[model samples]
Target: MLDQTDHDDNEPSAPIDMLEAYYAAHNWEFERHDDEIVASIKGSWTTYELRALWRDDDSVLQFLAFPDIKATDDRRPALYEAIGLVNEQLWIGHFELWSSSGILLYRHAALVDGEEEPMLSLSGAELLVESAIEECERFYPVFQFVLWGGKSPREALAAALVETHGEA
Candidate 1:
């Protein structure tokens, strides 16, 4: 059962329990600490540390997927530029650099009105997690290009954004 804390007028707030169900149904290993669910998901490009936190006060569930990307202080300017270019091409969610930690993560927030059912259903979580992992897989190499391969932000984005139809 989802634990919902009451907000003003005793309306039910967001719940993180759905994510637990999501993990179980997919047979994915995860640990729940308080209002957060942490899981390591393996993608085609790399593994991602996925964290889903529910904020009862705001009735929002936030998804954070880290692709293990890091950048040196000298390359942060380019890293930021690359993130912006990468975010522009995304239809959902966005990428952020936790400059202090030098880590890059993809973040998306789902909002619930807190009047009816839970904000994020188990089915919804399935889509969110899968989509996030796919996004991380698709763009993990772009960050690699900019941070290590000495590729410009625009160049990296252009190269990764290319879509190939039919495998050779």
Candidate 2:
């Protein structure tokens, strides 16, 4: 029965508490499993499974977004190259491919320490989820171009870098 109103101003909000409040306010559907909150979000190009968890010590908040795409053996090299290229330009979080399952995930972490608890906001949690989705939207086409379109790694990345401008 702990709702948003249950949070006391005098007490520091735990990471999961903040996340629940934020997600509930935004009307996003998620399941709380143990220490993790799992949600399915639809991006521009695909749907992603997003998970948020707090460390056992409650010092770190971790967010991970996994897309539906999986790299095959023949596509692994190009995907790796593209991941490295995309990661270099990112300010927060990084893309990683699990070798065993070829699963690609975007990972980000927010560190909570000292007096920073008072400063945490809902926007911060939203930013973490949004950033992961944005990264996936921005770079997923490169994987598609390389794997399905049979383009070289360089060409695929180049294609993805082409930005479209609309009339303002």
Candidate 3:
């Protein structure tokens, strides 16, 4: 638990310390880029680039997960439709298409108020990162189905949403 007394709104501690501690605790390798930390997370579908950054001005922590796939011009329409459907079902974060590059990414953010406890802020950061990664893993297959398997957007989403039964 983080003690409230350990943090002061006027004299807030550096955000990097909390982020580094969390990554170290999880034993996940990461690279620091100025105020951002970048890591690669391997999922069933593919490796995802996870980037976490803190905007001190806004007191917001943002996490983005980019998968190793790109949508072609023709596939953009279907992919966009699937993205909308998937984003609608997501509890946290939303999928976005980079129109310029045709790359898709999942993005989530946590706002940290200076008045709150540092631990609370750190926890929010962790949740944002975890949620982004989880959502990426959950939806990557749908993108793959549409992009490579020639499945319609609706069919790909349905395939991705299918639930399996446990062994009897």
Which candidate ranks first by TM-score, i.e. highest?
1
* Candidate 3 similarity to native, TM-score: 0.83
Local accuracy by lDDT, each model: 0.79, 0.78, 0.77
* Candidate 1 residue runs with Cα over 4 Å from true position: 1-14
| Backbone N/Cα/C clashes per model | 0, 0, 0
Name the weakest run of 10 consecutive residues (lDDT summed) in model 2: 1-10
Task: Write one digit per residue (lDDT tens) for candidate 2, span 1-168.
Answer: 234343445244666766676666656687897778888867788989888888857578888999888999988998898888878879999999999999889999888664645234555666777788888888889878977899887898889898789975
1-168 in candidate 1: lDDT tens per residue?
222321222332245776776666556789999989998767787777889998877778899999988888999999999999889878989999996888899999987554555555544666788788888888888899999988999898888878999979
After best superposition, candidate 1 residue 107: deviation in angstroms? 0.7
Q: Per-residue lDDT for 1-168 in model 3, tens only?
A: 334333444234456656665565566788987879887767788888888788877877777889888999999998999899898898778998999999999888767665654333455546666777778888888999998999998899999889889975
Clashing pairs in 3: none
Residue 44 displacement in candidate 2 (angstroms): 1.2
TM-score computed on alpha carbons, candidate 1: 0.86
- Judged by whole-model lDDT over C-alpha atoms, candidate 3 comes out at 0.77
Query: Which candidate leads in lDDT?
Result: 1
